[model samples]
Target: MEGGLLFQFCNWSTLLVCMVIKVPQIFALLSAKSSRGVSLKSLLLELAGFLVFLRYQSYYSYPLLTYLEYPILIAQDVILLLCVFHYNGSMNQAIPYIAVFLGGWYLLALQKWIIDLAMNLCTFISAASKFAQLQYLWEARDSGAVSALTWSLSAYTCATRVITTLMTTQDLMVLVRFLIMLALNIWVTATILRYRKTATKDE
Candidate 1:
C-alpha cells in the first residue's frame, strides 16, 4: 500500500509540474497579437487524434479518470481547430485531408472488436501531432505572433506525457516514444528561447 501511495505521489508531482509549466500555453494565444507563422499540420493531426480519443472515452465507458479534462479538451480543441483553419493558408488542400481524417475514424470504428485498436490509433495520432508541432516550432525563425504560453504549455505537456509513458511501462516501443517526445520538448523549448530573443531585439 505504501508503494502505491508513493507511485501516486510521483504521478501527481509530475502532473503538477507539467501543468504549471503548461499554463503559459493556455494564455499565449490570448496574449499574442496573431499566430503569424505557426503551421496547421499539427493542429489538423491533433483534431484527428482527438476524434480517436473521443472514441476511447466511449470504449472505456467514460470512466472517472477520463472525463477529468473533458471540458478543458472541448474548449481547447475548438479553439485549436479554428486557429488551424485560420492559419492554414491552403484551405483547398487542407480541407480534403481534414475530411479524410474525420471520415477514416468513423470507418475504422465500425469494427466492433477494434476498440483498443482505435484507442491505439488515437495515441499514435496525438503523438505524431505533438512531434510535428515540435518540428515546426524548431524550424520557425520568427514567432512574433505565436504565444509563448502555448509553446511553454507544449513543453510541459510533453514532459508530463513522458512521465506517464514511463510509469505505465506501456510497451516495448514506449522507451523510444518517450525519448522522441523528450527530444521534441527540449528542441521546442530551445526554439522558444531563441525566437523570444530575436523578437525582443526587434522591439
Candidate 2:
C-alpha cells in the first residue's frame, strides 16, 4: 500500500510538473524576443526522444501512468519549437523538421525491432540533446533568455520518473532512460545557473 501510494504520488507529481515545464523557457523567449541561448537541435532531438519513448510504452501496453507526461511534454516542445523558429526568423525552415518527425513517428512502429533499436538509441539521442544545450551555453557564455527554472523543473520530473519507473514497470530500458535523463537534466540546470550567475556578476 505504501509503495502504491508513493508510485501514484511520483507519477502524478511528474505529470503536474511536466504540464508547465516548458512555460518558463517559452516565456523567456517571448519576453526577450530572442532565442539566443536556446538550441534548436536540442529541442528537435529531445522531441524525437520523447516520441520514441512514448510510442514504446504505448506499443508494449505499459501502464498509462508511466508515460502519461510524454504527450504534454511533446506538446510543450512543439510550442517551444515554434517560438524558437519565430524568434530566429526561420519559421519556414520548420517545415522539414515537422515532416521528418511525423515520418519518424510512423516508422517507429513499423517493426518491433525498429522501436527496440530506437529505444536503445533513445538514451544517446536524448543525451545529445543535453549536450547540444550545453554546447550552446558554452559557446554563448550567457544564459540569455534560457530559463534556469525550466531546466530545474525538468530535473525534478526526471528524478520522480526514476522512482516511479522502479515502482511500476521496472523495465530496465525505461529505468536506464530516466536515470540518464535525471543526470543530464541536473547537468543542464547547473550549467544554466552558472551562466546566469556569471552574467549577473558582469553586470
Candidate 3:
C-alpha cells in the first residue's frame, strides 16, 4: 500500500474508533436525561466548526474518516438537543435554535473558496463557545452532561493528529485545522482537570 492509502486507512480506523467511543456520550445524555449542564451555544459553535471543516476538507484529499466525523457529530448534537429540551421541559423554545443552526451549517457547507481571514475569527469564536459549555458543566455540577467518551477519543486522536499533520502538505488549511483541534483538546482536558480539582475542594 502506498503512504496516502495507508494514511487513509488509519484515518478511517480512527474515525470508526471515535464514533464507537462517542456512543457512550449519547447514551449518557439519553439515560441521564440531563442536558442542563451542556451549553446550547457550544453545540452551535461545534456545528459551525464542522461546517468549516467540511468545506476545508473538500479542498483536500478527504480520507474516509473525514466523511464519518461530521455526521456522528451531527447525530450526537441532535441527541444532546433533545436531551436539553427534555430536561428543561422547553422543547418548543429549543426548536428555533436548532432549525437556525442546522440551516446555517447547510448553507455554509456549500462554499467553494474555502479560506478566508474570517475563518480564523469563526474558529476562535467556536473555541471560546466551548469554554462556555465548560463553565456550565462546572456550575451545574454535571460532567454527565459532557461527553466523557469524546474526551478519551480526543486523547487517542492527539497522537494521530501529529502524524496527520505530517501526512500531506498541499492544504495548509487542513493542517492548520488539525493542529487547532490538537491544541483545543489539550486545553479542554487541562481545564476539565483543573475544574475538577477546584470542585473537589469546594465539596
Candidate 4:
C-alpha cells in the first residue's frame, strides 16, 4: 500500500510540475523581450523527443500514469517555441517546423519498427537537446532569457519520472531514457546557474 501511494505521488507530482514547467522560461523571455540565451535548436529537438516518447508509450499501451505528463510538457513546449520565434522575429520560420513535427508524429506509428527505433534513439535525441542548450550557454556566456527555475523544475520532474518508471513500466528503454534526462536536466540547471552568476558579477 505504501508503494502504491508513493507511485501515485510521483505520478501526480510529475504532472503538476509539468503543467507549469515552461511558465518561468516563457515569462523570462517575455520579460526580457529577447530570446538571447534560449536555443531554438534545443527547443525543437526537445519537442521532437517529447513527441516520440509520448507516441511510443501510447503505442505500447503503457499505464497512463507512467506517461501522463508528456502531453502537458509538449503543449508547454509549443507555447515556448512560439515565444522563441516571436522574439527572434522569425515567426514565419515556425511554419516549416510545425509541419515537420506534425508529419513526424503521424509517421512514428506507421510501423512498430519505426517507433522502436525512435525510442532507442530518443535518449540520444533528448540528450542532444540538452547539449544544444549547454552549447548555447557556453557560447553566449549568459543566461539572458534562460530561467534556471524552469530547468530546476525540469530536473525535479525527470527525477520523479525515474522513480515512477521503475515502479510501473520497468521497461529498460524507458528507464534509461528517464535516467539520461534526469542527468541532463541537472547539468543544464547547473550551467544556467553558473552563467547567471557570471552575468550578475559582470553587472
Task: Name the TM-score of candidate 4.
Answer: 0.98
TM-score of candidate 3 relative to the true fold:
0.74
Give one digit per residue, the lDDT tens place, for model 3 in 83-176. Answer: 7777878889877876776676566545544335435555676566667666766676645446654665765664565565577543565556
Candidate 4's C-alpha runs over 4 A off are none
Q: TM-score per candidate, in order? A: 0.63, 0.98, 0.74, 0.98
Q: Which lDDT values do the candidates have, in the order given?
A: 0.56, 0.92, 0.63, 0.93
> Which consecutive 10 residues in model 3 have the weakest lDDT in total?
109-118
Query: Which has the higher lDDT value, candidate number 1 or candidate number 2?
Result: 2
Residue 131 in candidate 4, Cα distance off native in Å: 0.1
Tell me how many residue pairs clash in candidate 1: 3
The digit string of per-residue lDDT tens for model 1 on 70-183 reads 335545655655554555444356567667866776775677667667665655776777777667766776655555555555455445545554555444343454455556
Q: What CA root-mean-square deviation does each model show from the true structure? A: 4.7, 0.7, 3.5, 0.7
Give the winner by lDDT: 1 or 4. Answer: 4
Model 4: pairs clashing at backbone N, Cα or C within 3 Å: none
